[model samples]
Target: MKAPPFEYHRPSSLDEALGLLAELDEAKILAGGQSLLPLMSLRLGRPEHVVDIGDLGILDSLVVEPDGSVRVGALVTHRQVETSAEVAAHAPLLHAAAPMIGHRPIRTRGTVCGSIAHADPAAEMPAVALACNAAITAVSSRAAREIAAADFFEGYLQTVIEPDEIVTRVQFGPWPRHRRGAVVEQSRRSGDYAIIGLACWLDIEDNTITDAALSFFGVSDTPIRVAEAEDVLRGQAPTQSTFSAAGRTAAGVLRPTSDIHASANYRRHLAAVLTERGLAKATAESGETR
Candidate 1:
């Protein structure tokens, strides 16, 4: 299917792009076009104006800040995140989740900020952002603000971003060398959206779990951070039984909806399985025997 006819403006600068977004009614920002183009092609989204920010070099940076936090620009592709040594060392969870987004070709054209802005419940990037406590930067002609990950996503394919605002970057808090993270998911195929996905990490000291993050995707309207499960792991030794209990707790608290790809019960079961597996993997990566 062909996309509906729309006025396309290729803005050369961020200020020009912001002006276009603020001036046009029913305008859509196009960075990588991996998400918006598909919707437009399917006629699911029929914006009157398409503000293309592809040439805005200011939004194409991927920088590790002085404080060690990694800032991913709106135009930073998934492939760039996957291959970035700074991202791998500073934000291991983002690096680990990047390769799981889709196939290589898709990653090459898909932007990290675009995925987070899309707010798909089945997407991995949002869940990773949630687990890492990322701050999404939204810029408008009037002002700029940072939206916390917890407050950014509103519902399925929905976000708190105003129509005139563009998500310019996402800053993931630092994950030190001692902290370990992992991403695990169940999908129909290698590149398909996850049926149920888990992005988890552990902060361990002296072979005991000091803290843990359990963020689940494809289980609710938004990516959920299961505090109850994290509570179960805190202060406990990183052992099989502890992870299993946390897994059960996560499954018990979640209310996954039934879908054609997976039943509610099956999703719950996968959530439990992936939580356990992901925690164990992260613990092992941290070199904790207990």
Candidate 2:
């Protein structure tokens, strides 16, 4: 398949990109083009123009903040996140999920912002963002603003991005010291989209769970933060029984749809199993259990 004919613009700066986007209502920003190109090639997305941001220097580097948070540029590839020592030390959960995103070749070309912008319910980064409480920065010709991860994703393949806005950077807060985190997903085959996936972060203090965040994908219209499950784990002593209860609670909130890849019931089951496994691994990593 071939993409529909479209005008192409490679902007050298963020302002220029914003200008192009503002001027062309039907234009699409091209990051790594890993997702957009595929959709375009399939004729699923037919934009009047393609604005390439590859030449923007400011959107291509990872910066570690003095406050311990990490700012990932929009153009930063998944492979960079996977290998970044700064990301590994400060945001291990992101590092943990990076390798699971896709194969090495896909990761090499998939940009973090592109994945977030695509807002696939089955991708790992959105769940990681939700679990880590990351912030996304978006820019336009007029101004720039930050959006919380919880509010960034609106629905399936949908986001809060305005037509002319471009994601510039994503900032992730530092992972808690001694915190336990885990990511588990079930796909039909390696590198395929997940049928259900779970990412969890747990902080233990004085042998009790002080904080717990659980996020899920592929079981809902959007990446969901499992608040009920997190509530069940917080302030509780990590135990098999508690983890089991949390899993059930998490599974109860899922409203998965039957698709070619998996049935809703099967996805629900996977959600429960992955939630349990994630919770168990996170607890053990936190040293909450002897």
lDDT of 1 by residue, 1-290 (tens): 79999999998888888888888899988888989998999999999999988998989999999988999999999999999877888888899899998899899999999999999999999999999889999999999999999999999999999998999999998676568789999999998999999999888778889988999999999999999999999999889999999999999999999989999999999989998899878877743211
Estimate, for each residue in 127-198, the C-alpha lDDT of model 2 and write its tens digit.
Answer: 888888799999999889999999999998999999999999899986667588888889889888888898
Off by over 4 Å in 1: 286-290
What TM-score, to 2 decimals, does candidate 1 have?
Answer: 0.97
Displacement of residue 279 (Cα, Å) in model 2 is 1.6
Clashing pairs in 1: none
TM agreement with the true structure for every prediction? 0.97, 0.96
Worst 10 residues of 1 by lDDT: 281-290
| lDDT of predicted model 2 | 0.87
* Top candidate by TM-score: 1
